[model samples]
Target: MFRRLRSPGTARALTWAAALVLIAGIVAFVTVRLGQEDKGPANVGSVPTGFASEDFDPNATITEPKESDVPQAARVAAGEFVLAAVGRENLPKAWKLADPGLKRDCACTYKEWLTGNIPVQYFPTKGLRGASFSVDEVTPGHVVLQVLLTPAASSSLKPTAFYIGLKQRGKDAPWLVDYWAPVDVIAVPASPQG
Candidate 1:
Protein backbone atom coordinates (compact mmCIF):
# COMPACT_ATOMS: atom_id res chain seq x y z
CA MET A 1 0.00 0.00 0.00
CA PHE A 2 1.17 3.50 -0.89
CA ARG A 3 -0.23 6.70 0.62
CA ARG A 4 0.61 10.34 -0.17
CA LEU A 5 0.56 13.04 2.56
CA ARG A 6 -2.85 14.85 2.60
CA SER A 7 -1.16 18.20 3.33
CA PRO A 8 1.81 19.60 1.41
CA GLY A 9 2.82 21.47 4.64
CA THR A 10 3.33 18.14 6.47
CA ALA A 11 5.57 16.79 3.70
CA ARG A 12 7.63 20.02 3.66
CA ALA A 13 8.02 19.90 7.48
CA LEU A 14 9.21 16.25 7.34
CA THR A 15 11.76 17.13 4.68
CA TRP A 16 13.14 19.92 6.79
CA ALA A 17 13.34 17.62 9.83
CA ALA A 18 15.20 14.93 7.89
CA ALA A 19 17.79 17.42 6.63
CA LEU A 20 18.44 18.71 10.15
CA VAL A 21 18.84 15.15 11.51
CA LEU A 22 21.30 14.27 8.76
CA ILE A 23 23.39 17.37 9.46
CA ALA A 24 23.36 16.66 13.22
CA GLY A 25 24.44 13.04 12.65
CA ILE A 26 27.34 14.14 10.46
CA VAL A 27 28.43 16.70 13.05
CA ALA A 28 28.29 14.14 15.88
CA PHE A 29 30.32 11.60 13.88
CA VAL A 30 33.04 14.18 13.07
CA THR A 31 33.20 15.32 16.69
CA VAL A 32 33.59 11.74 17.97
CA ARG A 33 36.32 10.93 15.40
CA LEU A 34 38.24 14.09 16.28
CA GLY A 35 37.99 13.24 19.98
CA GLN A 36 39.32 9.73 19.35
CA GLU A 37 42.19 11.08 17.25
CA ASP A 38 43.19 13.40 20.06
CA LYS A 39 43.46 10.47 22.49
CA GLY A 40 44.95 7.99 20.02
CA PRO A 41 48.24 6.10 20.60
CA ALA A 42 50.01 8.35 18.10
CA ASN A 43 49.33 11.24 20.45
CA VAL A 44 50.60 9.37 23.52
CA GLY A 45 53.71 10.80 25.24
CA SER A 46 53.43 13.94 23.09
CA VAL A 47 54.14 16.33 25.94
CA PRO A 48 56.87 18.84 25.29
CA THR A 49 60.34 17.69 26.32
CA GLY A 50 63.07 19.97 27.61
CA PHE A 51 66.80 19.56 26.93
CA ALA A 52 67.87 20.59 30.44
CA SER A 53 68.54 17.82 32.91
CA GLU A 54 67.01 17.49 36.36
CA ASP A 55 70.29 18.59 37.98
CA PHE A 56 70.57 21.71 35.82
CA ASP A 57 70.53 24.95 37.80
CA PRO A 58 67.84 27.38 36.65
CA ASN A 59 69.67 30.34 38.22
CA ALA A 60 72.88 29.84 36.23
CA THR A 61 74.00 33.07 34.56
CA ILE A 62 76.63 33.75 31.93
CA THR A 63 78.23 37.18 31.56
CA GLU A 64 78.88 38.57 28.09
CA PRO A 65 82.01 40.63 27.37
CA LYS A 66 81.28 44.32 27.10
CA GLU A 67 82.34 46.08 23.92
CA SER A 68 83.36 49.74 24.11
CA ASP A 69 82.04 50.49 20.60
CA VAL A 70 78.54 48.98 21.11
CA PRO A 71 76.93 52.16 22.47
CA GLN A 72 78.26 54.38 19.68
CA ALA A 73 77.38 51.81 17.01
CA ALA A 74 73.87 51.29 18.38
CA ARG A 75 73.25 55.04 18.53
CA VAL A 76 74.47 55.51 14.98
CA ALA A 77 72.29 52.65 13.72
CA ALA A 78 69.18 53.98 15.49
CA GLY A 79 69.69 57.49 14.13
CA GLU A 80 70.26 56.18 10.63
CA PHE A 81 67.22 53.92 10.90
CA VAL A 82 64.98 56.81 11.93
CA LEU A 83 66.21 58.99 9.11
CA ALA A 84 65.85 56.20 6.58
CA ALA A 85 62.37 55.27 7.82
CA VAL A 86 61.09 58.84 7.51
CA GLY A 87 62.61 59.56 4.12
CA ARG A 88 60.59 57.98 1.30
CA GLU A 89 63.72 57.77 -0.86
CA ASN A 90 65.70 55.78 1.75
CA LEU A 91 63.27 52.89 2.11
CA PRO A 92 65.83 50.35 0.88
CA LYS A 93 68.37 51.42 3.50
CA ALA A 94 65.65 51.29 6.14
CA TRP A 95 64.72 47.78 5.11
CA LYS A 96 68.33 46.70 5.48
CA LEU A 97 68.62 48.21 8.97
CA ALA A 98 65.38 46.61 10.17
CA ASP A 99 65.50 43.23 11.93
CA PRO A 100 63.22 40.23 11.29
CA GLY A 101 60.87 41.28 14.10
CA LEU A 102 60.41 44.73 12.60
CA LYS A 103 59.81 43.27 9.15
CA ARG A 104 57.26 40.84 10.57
CA ASP A 105 55.53 43.57 12.50
CA CYS A 106 55.31 45.69 9.36
CA ALA A 107 53.49 42.84 7.55
CA CYS A 108 54.48 44.10 4.12
CA THR A 109 56.88 43.19 1.33
CA TYR A 110 60.06 45.12 0.53
CA LYS A 111 58.38 46.31 -2.65
CA GLU A 112 55.47 47.72 -0.69
CA TRP A 113 57.86 49.29 1.81
CA LEU A 114 59.73 50.93 -1.05
CA THR A 115 56.48 52.46 -2.26
CA GLY A 116 55.95 54.13 1.17
CA ASN A 117 53.26 51.61 2.12
CA ILE A 118 54.91 50.79 5.46
CA PRO A 119 53.31 50.36 8.86
CA VAL A 120 55.20 53.29 10.38
CA GLN A 121 53.69 56.75 10.37
CA TYR A 122 55.47 59.38 8.33
CA PHE A 123 55.81 63.06 9.16
CA PRO A 124 56.56 65.94 6.81
CA THR A 125 60.35 65.63 6.60
CA LYS A 126 60.56 68.97 4.85
CA GLY A 127 59.09 70.55 7.96
CA LEU A 128 61.50 68.72 10.28
CA ARG A 129 65.02 69.90 10.87
CA GLY A 130 66.88 67.26 12.85
CA ALA A 131 66.55 64.44 15.38
CA SER A 132 68.32 64.07 18.76
CA PHE A 133 68.33 60.82 20.71
CA SER A 134 69.34 59.78 24.25
CA VAL A 135 70.03 56.23 25.32
CA ASP A 136 67.31 55.13 27.74
CA GLU A 137 68.64 51.60 28.35
CA VAL A 138 71.63 49.75 26.96
CA THR A 139 72.60 46.09 27.37
CA PRO A 140 75.35 43.98 25.85
CA GLY A 141 73.14 42.98 22.92
CA HIS A 142 70.32 45.54 22.96
CA VAL A 143 69.77 49.30 23.28
CA VAL A 144 66.72 51.54 23.69
CA LEU A 145 66.85 55.20 22.74
CA GLN A 146 64.46 58.07 23.23
CA VAL A 147 64.48 60.23 20.10
CA LEU A 148 63.23 63.80 19.90
CA LEU A 149 62.69 65.14 16.43
CA THR A 150 62.97 68.90 16.07
CA PRO A 151 60.72 70.87 13.77
CA ALA A 152 61.98 73.57 11.41
CA ALA A 153 61.93 77.13 12.67
CA SER A 154 59.23 78.33 10.22
CA SER A 155 57.26 75.06 10.28
CA SER A 156 53.98 74.92 12.21
CA LEU A 157 54.55 71.28 13.23
CA LYS A 158 55.66 70.62 16.80
CA PRO A 159 58.54 68.44 17.94
CA THR A 160 57.83 64.70 18.22
CA ALA A 161 59.25 62.01 20.50
CA PHE A 162 59.74 58.33 19.73
CA TYR A 163 61.26 55.19 21.26
CA ILE A 164 63.57 53.01 19.24
CA GLY A 165 64.93 49.58 20.12
CA LEU A 166 68.05 48.17 18.50
CA LYS A 167 69.83 44.84 18.71
CA GLN A 168 73.15 43.28 17.77
CA ARG A 169 73.78 39.74 16.62
CA GLY A 170 77.15 39.47 18.35
CA LYS A 171 80.04 41.50 19.71
CA ASP A 172 81.37 42.32 16.27
CA ALA A 173 78.09 42.36 14.35
CA PRO A 174 76.39 45.53 13.25
CA TRP A 175 73.43 46.82 15.22
CA LEU A 176 69.93 46.55 13.71
CA VAL A 177 66.76 48.43 14.60
CA ASP A 178 64.07 45.98 15.79
CA TYR A 179 61.36 48.22 17.19
CA TRP A 180 60.09 51.78 16.73
CA ALA A 181 57.07 53.53 18.17
CA PRO A 182 55.79 56.93 19.31
CA VAL A 183 56.50 57.74 22.97
CA ASP A 184 52.86 58.08 24.00
CA VAL A 185 51.82 54.76 22.47
CA ILE A 186 53.98 52.64 24.81
CA ALA A 187 52.69 52.10 28.33
CA VAL A 188 55.14 52.19 31.22
CA PRO A 189 55.39 49.00 33.23
CA ALA A 190 54.65 49.06 36.97
CA SER A 191 57.50 48.55 39.39
CA PRO A 192 57.98 44.95 40.53
CA GLN A 193 58.43 46.06 44.19
CA GLY A 194 55.12 47.94 44.18
Candidate 2:
Protein backbone atom coordinates (compact mmCIF):
# COMPACT_ATOMS: atom_id res chain seq x y z
CA MET A 1 0.00 0.00 0.00
CA PHE A 2 1.23 3.53 -0.79
CA ARG A 3 1.94 5.71 2.22
CA ARG A 4 0.23 9.05 2.74
CA LEU A 5 2.16 12.16 1.66
CA ARG A 6 4.28 13.75 4.38
CA SER A 7 2.89 17.09 5.55
CA PRO A 8 6.10 18.42 7.12
CA GLY A 9 9.10 16.36 8.11
CA THR A 10 12.49 14.98 6.99
CA ALA A 11 10.53 13.24 4.24
CA ARG A 12 9.59 16.59 2.68
CA ALA A 13 13.17 17.90 2.77
CA LEU A 14 14.40 14.65 1.25
CA THR A 15 11.83 14.92 -1.52
CA TRP A 16 12.92 18.44 -2.41
CA ALA A 17 16.60 17.46 -2.48
CA ALA A 18 15.85 14.51 -4.73
CA ALA A 19 13.90 16.76 -7.11
CA LEU A 20 16.83 19.17 -7.30
CA VAL A 21 19.18 16.32 -8.11
CA LEU A 22 16.88 15.15 -10.89
CA ILE A 23 16.73 18.63 -12.39
CA ALA A 24 20.52 18.99 -12.21
CA GLY A 25 20.89 15.67 -14.00
CA ILE A 26 18.57 16.74 -16.80
CA VAL A 27 20.46 19.98 -17.26
CA ALA A 28 23.77 18.20 -17.31
CA PHE A 29 22.51 15.79 -19.95
CA VAL A 30 21.37 18.56 -22.25
CA THR A 31 24.66 20.40 -21.80
CA VAL A 32 26.68 17.36 -22.70
CA ARG A 33 24.57 16.76 -25.80
CA LEU A 34 25.08 20.29 -27.03
CA GLY A 35 28.82 20.18 -26.45
CA GLN A 36 29.06 17.00 -28.48
CA GLU A 37 27.03 18.55 -31.27
CA ASP A 38 29.57 21.23 -32.14
CA LYS A 39 31.13 20.83 -35.59
CA GLY A 40 34.61 19.53 -34.75
CA PRO A 41 36.73 22.28 -36.33
CA ALA A 42 34.73 24.04 -39.07
CA ASN A 43 35.20 22.99 -42.67
CA VAL A 44 34.05 24.52 -45.95
CA GLY A 45 31.03 22.30 -46.70
CA SER A 46 29.92 21.36 -43.17
CA VAL A 47 28.21 23.69 -40.69
CA PRO A 48 27.33 23.86 -37.03
CA THR A 49 23.75 22.86 -36.24
CA GLY A 50 21.11 25.55 -35.59
CA PHE A 51 23.13 27.52 -38.20
CA ALA A 52 22.52 27.17 -41.91
CA SER A 53 24.57 28.08 -44.98
CA GLU A 54 24.43 27.25 -48.69
CA ASP A 55 27.55 28.64 -50.39
CA PHE A 56 30.50 27.31 -48.36
CA ASP A 57 32.41 24.48 -49.96
CA PRO A 58 34.28 22.46 -47.32
CA ASN A 59 36.98 21.65 -49.85
CA ALA A 60 37.24 24.85 -51.80
CA THR A 61 40.74 26.31 -51.93
CA ILE A 62 40.35 29.80 -50.48
CA THR A 63 43.24 32.15 -49.80
CA GLU A 64 43.72 35.74 -48.72
CA PRO A 65 44.96 38.08 -51.42
CA LYS A 66 48.62 39.03 -51.61
CA GLU A 67 49.97 41.92 -49.49
CA SER A 68 49.13 44.28 -52.33
CA ASP A 69 45.66 42.85 -52.72
CA VAL A 70 44.11 43.54 -49.30
CA PRO A 71 42.52 46.96 -48.80
CA GLN A 72 43.40 49.61 -46.21
CA ALA A 73 40.31 49.31 -44.00
CA ALA A 74 40.33 45.54 -43.88
CA ARG A 75 43.91 45.63 -42.72
CA VAL A 76 43.03 48.07 -39.97
CA ALA A 77 40.14 45.96 -38.80
CA ALA A 78 42.35 42.90 -38.76
CA GLY A 79 44.93 44.78 -36.70
CA GLU A 80 42.38 45.84 -34.13
CA PHE A 81 41.17 42.27 -33.79
CA VAL A 82 44.73 41.01 -33.44
CA LEU A 83 45.51 43.52 -30.73
CA ALA A 84 42.29 42.66 -29.00
CA ALA A 85 43.18 38.99 -29.23
CA VAL A 86 46.61 39.50 -27.73
CA GLY A 87 45.16 41.55 -24.84
CA ARG A 88 45.93 45.03 -26.12
CA GLU A 89 42.70 46.48 -27.44
CA ASN A 90 40.39 47.62 -24.68
CA LEU A 91 36.70 46.76 -24.59
CA PRO A 92 35.70 49.67 -26.84
CA LYS A 93 38.22 48.81 -29.55
CA ALA A 94 37.16 45.17 -29.65
CA TRP A 95 33.56 46.32 -29.85
CA LYS A 96 34.38 48.62 -32.73
CA LEU A 97 33.27 46.12 -35.36
CA ALA A 98 31.12 43.97 -33.08
CA ASP A 99 27.37 44.10 -33.36
CA PRO A 100 25.83 46.08 -30.52
CA GLY A 101 24.38 42.97 -28.97
CA LEU A 102 27.67 41.07 -29.18
CA LYS A 103 29.96 43.57 -27.50
CA ARG A 104 30.57 41.48 -24.40
CA ASP A 105 31.37 38.41 -26.49
CA CYS A 106 34.17 40.01 -28.48
CA ALA A 107 37.01 39.00 -26.15
CA CYS A 108 36.84 35.31 -26.82
CA THR A 109 36.21 35.85 -30.52
CA TYR A 110 39.23 38.11 -30.80
CA LYS A 111 41.67 35.62 -29.32
CA GLU A 112 40.88 32.67 -31.58
CA TRP A 113 40.55 34.68 -34.76
CA LEU A 114 43.75 36.54 -34.10
CA THR A 115 45.73 33.52 -33.03
CA GLY A 116 44.63 30.75 -35.39
CA ASN A 117 42.26 32.11 -38.04
CA ILE A 118 42.42 35.81 -38.90
CA PRO A 119 46.14 35.66 -39.64
CA VAL A 120 45.23 33.35 -42.49
CA GLN A 121 41.78 34.58 -43.45
CA TYR A 122 42.78 38.21 -43.89
CA PHE A 123 46.06 39.22 -45.46
CA PRO A 124 46.49 42.12 -43.09
CA THR A 125 47.00 39.80 -40.15
CA LYS A 126 49.63 38.01 -42.18
CA GLY A 127 51.66 41.25 -42.18
CA LEU A 128 50.47 41.86 -45.74
CA ARG A 129 48.34 44.91 -45.28
CA GLY A 130 46.75 47.20 -47.85
CA ALA A 131 46.24 44.44 -50.41
CA SER A 132 43.93 45.30 -53.28
CA PHE A 133 40.69 43.39 -53.62
CA SER A 134 41.35 41.35 -56.69
CA VAL A 135 38.45 38.89 -56.32
CA ASP A 136 35.95 40.45 -54.03
CA GLU A 137 32.74 38.60 -54.71
CA VAL A 138 30.75 40.91 -52.47
CA THR A 139 31.32 44.22 -50.78
CA PRO A 140 31.76 44.47 -47.00
CA GLY A 141 28.34 46.04 -46.43
CA HIS A 142 26.59 43.28 -48.36
CA VAL A 143 28.26 39.93 -48.12
CA VAL A 144 28.58 37.08 -45.62
CA LEU A 145 31.85 35.70 -46.92
CA GLN A 146 32.93 32.21 -45.83
CA VAL A 147 36.68 31.82 -46.17
CA LEU A 148 37.97 28.23 -46.23
CA LEU A 149 41.40 28.52 -44.59
CA THR A 150 44.07 25.90 -45.07
CA PRO A 151 47.80 25.85 -44.41
CA ALA A 152 49.66 25.58 -47.71
CA ALA A 153 51.87 22.92 -46.12
CA SER A 154 48.94 20.67 -45.28
CA SER A 155 47.64 20.57 -48.80
CA SER A 156 45.68 17.39 -48.13
CA LEU A 157 44.47 18.08 -44.61
CA LYS A 158 40.88 19.26 -44.11
CA PRO A 159 40.51 22.91 -43.32
CA THR A 160 42.43 23.04 -39.99
CA ALA A 161 41.92 26.77 -39.60
CA PHE A 162 38.68 28.69 -39.10
CA TYR A 163 36.46 29.67 -42.04
CA ILE A 164 34.43 32.60 -40.78
CA GLY A 165 31.11 33.09 -42.59
CA LEU A 166 30.20 36.73 -42.11
CA LYS A 167 26.54 37.56 -41.60
CA GLN A 168 25.65 41.22 -41.96
CA ARG A 169 22.05 42.29 -41.47
CA GLY A 170 20.61 44.87 -43.87
CA LYS A 171 19.28 45.09 -47.44
CA ASP A 172 21.48 42.11 -48.15
CA ALA A 173 19.64 40.34 -45.27
CA PRO A 174 22.70 38.08 -44.87
CA TRP A 175 25.59 38.66 -47.19
CA LEU A 176 28.10 35.83 -47.48
CA VAL A 177 31.06 37.82 -46.20
CA ASP A 178 34.04 37.54 -48.51
CA TYR A 179 35.70 40.31 -46.56
CA TRP A 180 37.84 38.91 -43.77
CA ALA A 181 37.03 40.95 -40.68
CA PRO A 182 34.89 39.15 -38.08
CA VAL A 183 35.99 36.95 -35.15
CA ASP A 184 33.78 33.92 -35.56
CA VAL A 185 35.89 31.88 -33.13
CA ILE A 186 36.41 32.80 -29.49
CA ALA A 187 39.14 31.15 -27.47
CA VAL A 188 37.77 29.94 -24.12
CA PRO A 189 40.71 28.18 -22.49
CA ALA A 190 38.76 27.42 -19.35
CA SER A 191 35.15 28.36 -20.05
CA PRO A 192 34.47 25.69 -22.66
CA GLN A 193 31.83 24.35 -20.30
CA GLY A 194 29.21 26.29 -22.20
Candidate 3:
Protein backbone atom coordinates (compact mmCIF):
# COMPACT_ATOMS: atom_id res chain seq x y z
CA MET A 1 0.00 0.00 0.00
CA PHE A 2 1.31 3.40 -1.00
CA ARG A 3 0.50 6.58 0.86
CA ARG A 4 1.47 10.15 -0.16
CA LEU A 5 3.49 12.01 2.52
CA ARG A 6 1.55 14.82 4.21
CA SER A 7 4.17 17.56 4.70
CA PRO A 8 3.85 19.34 8.12
CA GLY A 9 0.08 19.83 8.39
CA THR A 10 -0.82 22.51 5.87
CA ALA A 11 -4.20 20.71 6.19
CA ARG A 12 -5.22 19.09 9.47
CA ALA A 13 -7.52 16.82 7.43
CA LEU A 14 -4.61 15.50 5.33
CA THR A 15 -2.53 14.90 8.54
CA TRP A 16 -5.25 12.75 10.07
CA ALA A 17 -5.75 10.79 6.83
CA ALA A 18 -2.01 9.95 6.61
CA ALA A 19 -1.95 8.66 10.18
CA LEU A 20 -5.00 6.44 9.48
CA VAL A 21 -3.32 5.05 6.33
CA LEU A 22 -0.16 4.20 8.30
CA ILE A 23 -2.15 2.35 10.94
CA ALA A 24 -4.06 0.41 8.26
CA GLY A 25 -0.79 -0.60 6.57
CA ILE A 26 0.61 -1.99 9.83
CA VAL A 27 -2.49 -4.10 10.38
CA ALA A 28 -2.43 -5.39 6.81
CA PHE A 29 1.26 -6.37 7.11
CA VAL A 30 0.68 -8.40 10.28
CA THR A 31 -2.30 -10.20 8.72
CA VAL A 32 -0.26 -11.02 5.62
CA ARG A 33 2.66 -12.29 7.73
CA LEU A 34 0.41 -14.66 9.64
CA GLY A 35 -0.43 -16.23 6.27
CA GLN A 36 -3.37 -18.28 4.98
CA GLU A 37 -3.75 -22.00 5.78
CA ASP A 38 -3.98 -24.56 3.01
CA LYS A 39 -7.45 -25.94 2.49
CA GLY A 40 -6.86 -29.22 0.67
CA PRO A 41 -9.11 -31.42 -1.43
CA ALA A 42 -12.50 -32.31 0.06
CA ASN A 43 -12.39 -35.57 2.01
CA VAL A 44 -15.60 -37.53 2.29
CA GLY A 45 -15.11 -38.41 5.96
CA SER A 46 -12.86 -35.83 7.66
CA VAL A 47 -9.59 -34.01 7.17
CA PRO A 48 -6.42 -36.06 7.79
CA THR A 49 -3.77 -35.22 10.39
CA GLY A 50 0.10 -34.95 10.41
CA PHE A 51 0.19 -32.75 7.33
CA ALA A 52 1.75 -30.01 9.43
CA SER A 53 -1.36 -28.09 10.41
CA GLU A 54 -0.62 -24.63 11.73
CA ASP A 55 -3.48 -25.03 14.22
CA PHE A 56 -1.64 -27.94 15.89
CA ASP A 57 -0.74 -27.35 19.52
CA PRO A 58 2.46 -28.98 20.82
CA ASN A 59 1.26 -29.16 24.40
CA ALA A 60 -2.25 -30.49 24.64
CA THR A 61 -4.18 -32.89 26.85
CA ILE A 62 -6.79 -35.19 25.38
CA THR A 63 -9.67 -36.37 27.47
CA GLU A 64 -9.55 -39.22 25.02
CA PRO A 65 -7.96 -39.75 21.63
CA LYS A 66 -10.54 -39.92 18.88
CA GLU A 67 -11.38 -43.47 17.74
CA SER A 68 -11.59 -42.54 14.05
CA ASP A 69 -7.93 -41.58 13.86
CA VAL A 70 -6.93 -45.28 13.95
CA PRO A 71 -8.51 -46.17 10.61
CA GLN A 72 -7.24 -42.87 9.22
CA ALA A 73 -3.66 -43.82 10.09
CA ALA A 74 -4.07 -47.33 8.60
CA ARG A 75 -5.49 -45.86 5.41
CA VAL A 76 -2.54 -43.51 5.20
CA ALA A 77 -0.13 -46.35 5.90
CA ALA A 78 -1.73 -48.86 3.52
CA GLY A 79 -3.26 -46.83 0.73
CA GLU A 80 -2.92 -43.08 0.39
CA PHE A 81 0.65 -42.36 1.42
CA VAL A 82 2.00 -45.56 -0.15
CA LEU A 83 -0.24 -47.40 -2.63
CA ALA A 84 -1.70 -44.40 -4.46
CA ALA A 85 1.71 -43.19 -5.56
CA VAL A 86 2.92 -46.08 -7.79
CA GLY A 87 2.13 -48.81 -10.43
CA ARG A 88 0.87 -48.14 -13.95
CA GLU A 89 -2.63 -49.69 -14.17
CA ASN A 90 -3.81 -49.46 -10.57
CA LEU A 91 -3.29 -46.34 -8.48
CA PRO A 92 -0.19 -47.43 -6.58
CA LYS A 93 -0.91 -47.00 -2.92
CA ALA A 94 1.91 -49.56 -2.94
CA TRP A 95 4.65 -47.21 -1.83
CA LYS A 96 3.31 -46.68 1.67
CA LEU A 97 3.58 -50.42 2.34
CA ALA A 98 6.40 -51.21 -0.09
CA ASP A 99 9.96 -52.06 0.94
CA PRO A 100 12.75 -49.59 0.16
CA GLY A 101 14.38 -51.85 -2.45
CA LEU A 102 11.14 -52.59 -4.26
CA LYS A 103 10.28 -48.89 -4.09
CA ARG A 104 13.60 -48.12 -5.78
CA ASP A 105 13.55 -51.13 -8.12
CA CYS A 106 10.03 -50.53 -9.38
CA ALA A 107 11.40 -47.33 -10.96
CA CYS A 108 10.07 -43.92 -10.07
CA THR A 109 7.82 -43.44 -13.09
CA TYR A 110 7.68 -46.88 -14.66
CA LYS A 111 7.31 -50.60 -13.86
CA GLU A 112 8.45 -52.33 -17.06
CA TRP A 113 10.21 -55.19 -15.32
CA LEU A 114 7.38 -55.79 -12.88
CA THR A 115 4.63 -55.58 -15.49
CA GLY A 116 6.40 -58.19 -17.60
CA ASN A 117 6.70 -60.64 -14.72
CA ILE A 118 3.30 -60.04 -13.10
CA PRO A 119 0.23 -62.06 -14.09
CA VAL A 120 -2.12 -59.24 -15.01
CA GLN A 121 -5.23 -61.37 -15.59
CA TYR A 122 -5.32 -62.45 -11.96
CA PHE A 123 -7.15 -59.20 -11.55
CA PRO A 124 -10.32 -59.85 -13.53
CA THR A 125 -12.10 -57.21 -15.57
CA LYS A 126 -15.52 -57.65 -13.95
CA GLY A 127 -17.42 -58.61 -10.76
CA LEU A 128 -16.72 -58.09 -7.06
CA ARG A 129 -13.34 -58.88 -5.54
CA GLY A 130 -11.51 -58.51 -2.20
CA ALA A 131 -8.04 -59.24 -0.80
CA SER A 132 -6.65 -60.87 2.38
CA PHE A 133 -3.26 -62.01 3.69
CA SER A 134 -1.65 -64.92 5.60
CA VAL A 135 1.90 -65.59 6.74
CA ASP A 136 4.09 -67.96 4.74
CA GLU A 137 4.93 -71.27 6.48
CA VAL A 138 8.48 -71.88 5.22
CA THR A 139 9.55 -68.46 4.04
CA PRO A 140 10.11 -65.98 6.84
CA GLY A 141 10.15 -62.87 4.66
CA HIS A 142 7.09 -63.69 2.61
CA VAL A 143 3.33 -63.30 2.95
CA VAL A 144 0.54 -64.84 0.90
CA LEU A 145 -2.60 -62.85 0.22
CA GLN A 146 -5.73 -64.51 -1.11
CA VAL A 147 -7.86 -62.48 -3.50
CA LEU A 148 -11.47 -63.61 -3.50
CA LEU A 149 -13.97 -63.04 -6.25
CA THR A 150 -17.75 -63.21 -6.28
CA PRO A 151 -20.14 -63.68 -9.24
CA ALA A 152 -17.60 -65.72 -11.14
CA ALA A 153 -16.71 -64.10 -14.45
CA SER A 154 -17.27 -67.23 -16.55
CA SER A 155 -20.50 -68.46 -14.95
CA SER A 156 -22.80 -67.76 -11.99
CA LEU A 157 -21.71 -65.15 -9.42
CA LYS A 158 -20.25 -67.58 -6.90
CA PRO A 159 -16.97 -66.72 -5.11
CA THR A 160 -13.50 -68.02 -6.05
CA ALA A 161 -10.07 -67.33 -4.56
CA PHE A 162 -6.59 -66.62 -5.96
CA TYR A 163 -3.42 -66.81 -3.90
CA ILE A 164 -0.59 -64.36 -4.52
CA GLY A 165 2.88 -63.78 -3.09
CA LEU A 166 3.68 -60.67 -1.08
CA LYS A 167 7.21 -59.96 0.04
CA GLN A 168 7.90 -58.78 3.56
CA ARG A 169 10.57 -56.11 3.51
CA GLY A 170 12.90 -55.60 6.45
CA LYS A 171 11.34 -56.13 9.87
CA ASP A 172 8.85 -53.28 9.69
CA ALA A 173 7.72 -53.14 6.04
CA PRO A 174 4.12 -53.86 5.16
CA TRP A 175 3.55 -56.71 2.69
CA LEU A 176 4.35 -55.75 -0.91
CA VAL A 177 2.51 -57.73 -3.56
CA ASP A 178 5.10 -59.34 -5.85
CA TYR A 179 3.42 -62.25 -7.57
CA TRP A 180 -0.22 -62.48 -8.65
CA ALA A 181 -1.53 -65.66 -10.26
CA PRO A 182 -5.06 -66.75 -11.01
CA VAL A 183 -6.26 -70.17 -9.77
CA ASP A 184 -6.58 -71.69 -13.24
CA VAL A 185 -3.53 -70.24 -14.94
CA ILE A 186 -0.95 -72.89 -15.99
CA ALA A 187 2.34 -72.92 -14.12
CA VAL A 188 5.36 -71.48 -15.91
CA PRO A 189 7.69 -74.17 -17.24
CA ALA A 190 10.94 -74.46 -15.34
CA SER A 191 12.83 -75.13 -18.57
CA PRO A 192 12.28 -73.49 -21.98
CA GLN A 193 10.35 -75.65 -24.46
CA GLY A 194 12.20 -76.48 -27.68
Task: Report clashes for each candidate as comma-separated counts.
Answer: 0, 19, 9
Which residue pairs in model 1 clash with each other? none
User: What does candidate 2's lDDT look like per residue over 1-194, in tens digits?
Assistant: 23545546667888899999999999999886676566332222344333445645557664432444434444455445433422233434544544433433333465553333222222212222221222222333432223333323423323323323233456534222233332355332221121
Residues 39-156, model 1: lDDT tens digits? 5532222321222355444455423223343478787787778768854448899999998888898899998778766755564455568877765555568776778887678855
RMSD (CA, angstroms), candidate 3: 21.2
Task: Choose the strongest candidate by lDDT.
Answer: 1
**What TM-score, to 2 decimals, does candidate 1 have?**
0.56
How much does candidate 2 score in TM-score?
0.27
> Worst ten-residue run, lDDT, model 1?
185-194
Residues 57-119, model 3: lDDT tens digits: 445432222223222223234322211322122434443344455546555544543342322
**lDDT scores in order:** 0.69, 0.39, 0.40
Best candidate, TM-score:
1
RMSD of 1: 15.1
